[model samples]
Target chain A: MHEDRQQFIQGVRDCLPTLLGYIGIGAAFGIVGASSNVSLLEIALLSLLVYAGSAQFIICALFVVHTPIPVIVATTFIVNLRHFLMGLAIAPAFSQYSMKQNVLLGTLLTDETFGVAASKLTKQTKLNASWMHGLNITAYLCWLLSSLAGAMLGQWIEEPTVFGLDFALPAMFVALLIIQLQQQAAGKLMHLLAVVGYTIIFMVVFSFVVPSHLAVLLSTMSAATIGVLTKR
Target chain B: MTISTTMLLIIIGCCLVTLIPRIAPFILLKKVSLPKWMTDWLSYIPICILTALIVQGMWTAEQGKLIISWHYMLALIPTVIAALWTRSLAVTVIVGVVAMALVRMFS
Candidate 1:
């Protein structure tokens, strides 16, 4: 127990840099959501619950479109389906953990957490549960605080888009994708196929769709399908 | 438009749908072994979904009009270059914003 606590502290220290990035990005998201006329409560809810950056951005866009409830729900489900895969990919690493521990850790699983944890697992035999938990918790806390700050200050900023804030979400993803491709084995090919498939589906469907939500839903489903079919 | 009860309900519904998938894995994956094929496919979803989103964001205008404007083209130049060279999230986003702003200004 003592050793676990120490390792967890170390994990938090190591993950600090990554956590800072999530804060900045998450705050930007909060600002965007606020600027889109979403209420402070909604922004907070999204920050705490949705947690997925890109999906939150899309949700805000749907809000702007005043999309129907059913469509919005469907779109959110599709966009976040990747989280399921992320959870599964990390399952083997946590096989020894109790179901409660898995559930707790799973709640904190994000792209950043998974990347760091998976890399760590590859290098070491025995997992440091505390450190893993600490890393994820630190990131999650940063995200929540940053989002709250953004929501509070969002109304004061008249033009987030004019400040070029709208570009951050996509830019962040592109950057992350590029880095992931360079570092992970087979990352480039997998990411390239995913991107190409998504783009084709979005372009084909978006033009004819009335509610923009459909474009996101269909594209995400198509991507998931492609991902499932081509898995190693 | 007034904040109608209907709209509020819609928002609540949307929230539930979004939260379920994220929450489900924590519950379901705890006891089950996901098939190998499923695992393989899930790996690719992020890249594909992100690509579709970014391309659409860069190209589409209001009402789905495709605009191959010089501003967008110019913005892409810096974005692509920054993404490939730096591969840093902050750098890429900063460059993209700067590129778009410059394109919007000069054009």
Candidate 2:
């Protein structure tokens, strides 16, 4: 039990970097939701429930455009479809845990948490529910609280874009992806580059015809398939 | 804006859609054994998804016309460098945002 507590604390420590980025993005989100006349409670609930940065932004944008409900729902579904893969990727680590535990843990999984958890898994080679709990819950709390703060403080910041806060998500992703890539074998860099090209091409081509989120799903699946085929 | 019945419905719909995709896979696949090849494929999902998302964020279609934001592209360079050098998410984001703010200020 003591060891579990230690691991859990470590998980939260690992999430410190994410906390900084989340506050910036979450605050930006709060500002948008506030200006859109979205109630503070609703904004907080959206952060609490939806818990996705890009998807929440899309939801706000769609609402601003007055897009139809069904379309908005469908778009959110497609955009979030990738979370299935994220859950799947970490499934093996939690295989020993109960289904209920997995379900609970899965709820806290996000792109940043997935990256952090996956990286830890690659190194630790053991599944500690406490560690995963600490990592995920810390990130989740940061997102929820920071967004709430953003919503409440919405009027204070007029233009997040002028300050370049919009780049937070992409910057985080780029860093995370690079870290993952750096961990791979040098010989596999070429294969990784090819996989990137394959993924981007599929995304660009499919995005023209399909809804943007669906295009992401299709392209990611194709890229993964290509990775599987090329692996020795 | 105040929440209306229609907005509530939309929010619920969004919640259901997000919840199902995120929570279902682990529950459904918990006991089932996945193929080895499938596991291999799963490894690439992160890269593909992140790249696709970043690209989508950097460019978008407006009125059926594709428009690229050169500012984001410019910011990406410094961000990439900082990420590679520091491998710190906080530093990379700070540098990227600063780079972008500078670009927007000048141009």
Candidate 3:
């Protein structure tokens, strides 16, 4: 097999766990979308185009409350601002690809993809464009299709939590964090601990005062700064 | 459910909001040179962001109060162990799902 083919296959293989988690969240999003007085087509389009799980959920909640259009748009933008950081984090690796390829990869860079790619790229020195495409495309399809299933069967699976599917996303994230933590340099552990500690405290104290999206952004920035300053 | 004009605009606005963040960095920063300090700081982005996301996932705010769910914390035990022991994302997720399901089933 060609090296690129092998890398692509490996990328798909690595995404299997994330796919399992996405299946549940995507369906939940679909169910919520269906119940929010939006057409199935609109729900599907949102998943296909917007493609951010938390942001989509927030949009649905605001939509149900009949939030003003500007508020909804602004909230979604703030919720998704983390993607800007994700994009910058991966920019160096993607510098090797063409503008068109970068566009495609950027569109597909969800939290799961960013998590998987960040760890994978850190371990390997070379940039595998096809491998990344494989990973992103697989995750993208899982999210889109599972969401479609949820929308189609929204009524039937009214309570997705009954089956413990709500835990899928958290579990997936925990797993990703563990992997990333294990890959960190020995001296970096202190920074990791500080970042985790600071973020928890920030979230607990400010979750009510600030919008959740802004809280997230603030916590992330602070944690990254803590890491940078503490790094030797 | 039927779509209204407002919903359509919100969707389009959402598309733009998400698209710009994802696409802009790749386009603008692709050829731009970043300082070593900036790159070192960027290295922390994933760990910091993921940590914050995990914390956010743990407890949700209800009526302006933080409600911590013991269930999520319990499930993380097995999930973290599986992640460390197996080092396999699939196995870790499966263990986590099964652990949570069992907890929900019995508790």
Model 2 - which docking category? medium
Error of 3 at B41 (Å): 0.7
Best by lDDT: 3
**lDDT per residue, candidate 3, B1-107, as tens digits?**
46678888999999998899988888877779689988888887887788777777667787888778888888888988888898877787788888888878888
- Model 2 chain B worst lDDT run, 10 consecutive residues: B57-66
Candidate 1 DockQ score? Answer: 0.40
Chain A (alone) TM-scores for all candidate structures:
0.72, 0.93, 0.92
Per-candidate Cα lDDT values, in order, are 0.65, 0.82, 0.83
DockQ of each: 0.40, 0.67, 0.65
- TM-score, cand. 1: 0.71
lDDT of 2 by residue, A77-174 (tens): 88888899888877777878788888888887888888777766545544777888898899888888888888888878766788788788788888
Fraction of native contacts under 8 Å reproduced by each candidate: 0.44, 0.65, 0.70
- Candidates 2 and 3, the one with greater lDDT: 3
> Model 1 Cα displacement at A123 (Å)?
7.7
Candidate 3 per-residue C-alpha lDDT over A59-135 given as tens digits, one digit per residue, 9 for 90 to 100: 98899998999999998999999999989998778788788988888888888889998887668755677888889
Docking outcome class, model 3 = medium
Residue A172, model 2: Cα distance from true site in angstroms: 0.5
Assess chain B of each prediction and give its TM-score: 0.74, 0.88, 0.86
User: Backbone collision count in every prediction?
Assistant: 4, 2, 0
